[model samples]
Target chain A: MEFQGFRRKDGSVGTRNTIGILSTVVCANEVADDISRHVEGATAFMHQQGCCQTPVDIARVNETLIGLGKNPNLAAVLLVSLGCESTAVGEVAKAISEAGKRVETIVIQEVGGAAKSIAEGTLLVQDMVQEASRLERTSCPVRDLVLGLKCGSSDTTSGLAPNPALGIASDLLIEAGGTSILGEVTEFIGAEHLLALHARDEDVGKQILDLVKRMENRAKSAGQDIRGGQPTGGNIKGGLTTIEEKSLGAIAKAGTAPIQAVYEYGIAPQVKGLVVMDSPGREPEILTGLAAAGCTVIAFTTGRGAPQGFPFVPVIKITGNKVTWDKLRDHMDMDVSSVMEGEETLPDAGKRIFREILQVASGMLTKAEISGYTKAMDIYTVGPVI
Target chain B: MKNDAIMIHEKDNVATALRDIKPNEKVVVGTGDKSSVIQVQQPIPYGHKFAVRDIPGGEDILKYGEVMGRATQDIAGGTHAHIHNIESLRGRGDLER
Candidate 1:
């Protein structure tokens, strides 16, 4: 269960050593992206938030950025900011520096223009990468692993196969004293009762139910039904009907473990067994939320096909469609389609997936990771642009 | 176990195809007491659905014991139950519907 990994000064273990160029607001995304383009081994964490949000929402944005910079996977961080943006770029750099990683900041307004900021940021990132390359991995136990669970573009086989297989893997990780996080609160609407059964206590169970209620209310107030935009076209073509039916299938990814805790979007889980994070169902937002929560690896289940991965974490894409596996082989990591053809049992598929997770954790890159499909990541926001 | 295909729940009148059913290929449904063997009108892919009982126009198509969509036209056993013949009842645009 030991894998070679970089140990961060904050005491967190990371599978990948990366230098991150983070944009403090939407305005500075171009600068960060430009800087990242010039620097090898550098990834940009760009998002559309950081200005004119309600105080609570602004704080949430600020916290997620700071957390991303502090993530152990990052060997160093460079914050790119627009001088007028409300997001606290200075505070973000201070937090990451305190976590013991090299941290620096570049403000476009103060730096004169985008060109100058990009030049300065690129040089800064190159230096960080040099420092990052000097760091070496040490033996880390399985218990230190933080795993994120997510499924997108679902179809019938998702419920029948990959999700349950992932559940088994989640259970195995938890049994090894690792942390597993389940996200996408909207999908839990119809299946909340099932998940509540796994809560650590009645209060946790109620909290799980309440989160579902809030999601439903948000949709309702927007003059839409929860099912209005669910089970999407791909899902229906793949044979899922109601939100209830999809939920029934979705919960299989949790395996059969007790829910140890629940967390808000982008909040790190305090205790680890199986915890739920409140996140939207979109790939970019949810993936960002999970990574910001400090997951070192992610197990993503897709039925139709989704190929995006995060900047610093390894995403293991598992699919149940043999056709998708063969057709999109370049994008997918593992195929449990054998479960559908009766070539493999659920447990057998689960074991195969678990082994794959171990392999990836030990430095094997996923197909998405290999193709450099990490640019489509963003933090979810609910406010108007300002 | 009848093994033709499972209805998933008692409330569902349609069953998903566990394997591909070729056009005009005959398949059986239900058990001996109420069994019926019908020919597929068109090729239906695996993981897709076939009508278990007759579904008239405007009736909702049930699968997994819930309404997946409403039948836009009469659907018989062994016919593909998807967008061409069924329309989503949950998230349709009013004018389009």
Candidate 2:
């Protein structure tokens, strides 16, 4: 139940060690991306939220940024600031610095322009990267591992095979006293009761129910029924008849473990075992939420297919359908198609996935990591663009 | 030989067709006494479901041993079971925002 991990000075364990080039606002994304791109051992945290929001919403933005900066995976942080955004860049840097990592800042307005800021940011990133590169991996127990679970572009086979297989793997991880995060509040629409049943207590169950209700109502507030979008055409073509069916399959990623706690979008899990996060099902949003939640790795289950990866975390794409696996072999990391083929059992596949997670945690780059598919990521925002 | 359609649970009335099943193609459900076979009444695409027996409209359509939805129309044995016939019984328009 132990895997190689990087020990952060914050007394937390990290599965990956890298310097993060974090932006204070969307306007500063280019500068952050430039710095991270030009420097090795660095990843950019590009997001599109900073200004024009209510106080409540802006607070959410700040909280998530701080959470991301505090992620143990980041050995050091070089924050790029546009200097006028609502997100507290200084506070974010201070928090990460207090967590015992190298922290530096480059403010565009203060530095005169984006060009000068990027130049400063690049040097800062280079120094942080060099420092991060020297960190070594040590044996860490399963309890230190945090696994983020996500399902996207799902077909019927997702619920039947890979999803269930991942559920088993999730259960294995949780049983080993590790943490597994089940996100995608929208996907829980028709399956909330089932999910609530896994909650540790009645209050936690109510929280699970309320989160599902809130997410559904949020969609409804936009003036449309969620059913119009639930079973994506691909899901129907793949044999899912209703939103209920799709959700039933989607929830399988959490396995049957007790829901230990509930977390909001971007708030990292504070406890061990299976935790649920309030997040959308989209790749960009959920992936960012997972990374902010401090998940060391992502277990992405897909039946149809998904190829996106987060800039810092390693995304391990798993598929249940043989056809999608064959079609997207280069994108997919593990194939649980044999479960449907009756060639392999679910528990066996689950064990194999757990082993793969250990390997990925031990620095064996995932397909998403190897192909450099990380970059198209963003933090989730509930409020409008205005 | 492996079953063409996978029966996920004993209570499931429909089995997922392993491949794109053409009309008149024989679809095997499982092995042993619980197993059954049906003829594909229509073209069932890969990853789609087909009824193992006739299902009356308004009855619960079971999958993974749970109520996935309710059939909106009578579906004959081996007919494709999908949105055209099934109405999601939970949380679509049922919840009050």
True contacts kept of each: 0.12, 0.50
Candidate that would win on lDDT: 2
What candidate 2 gets wrong by more than 4 Å, as runs, is B31-33, B90-97
Write down the lDDT that model 1 would get.
0.81
Candidate 1, superposed: residue stretches over 4 Å from native: A225-228, B1-14, B22-45, B51-97
Best by TM-score: 2
DockQ (Cα-based) per candidate?
0.20, 0.51
Task: Supply the TM-score of chain A against the true chain A for every candidate structure.
Answer: 0.97, 0.97
| Candidate 1 lDDT over residue span A1-386, tens digit each | 77778888878898889998889988888989899889889898888888887777788888899778877788998899999988877777887798888889998999999988988888888888998898888889888889999998898789878999999999998988889999888788667888999998999999899988877666555554435377677787777756666777788899888998889988888897999999888898999999989899999999988889998889999999888899998899999988766578889888898888877887898988789898877777765554
- Tell me the lDDT of candidate 2: 0.85
- Superposed on the true interface residues, model 2 gives a C-alpha RMSD in angstroms of 2.9
- Candidate 2's displacement at residue A271, Å, is 1.6
Q: Write the per-residue lDDT of candidate 2 for residues A53-130, one digit (tens) a residue.
A: 777778877887787888888898888889888888777788778888888989899999978888888888887777
The Cα RMSD of model 2 versus the native structure comes to 1.9
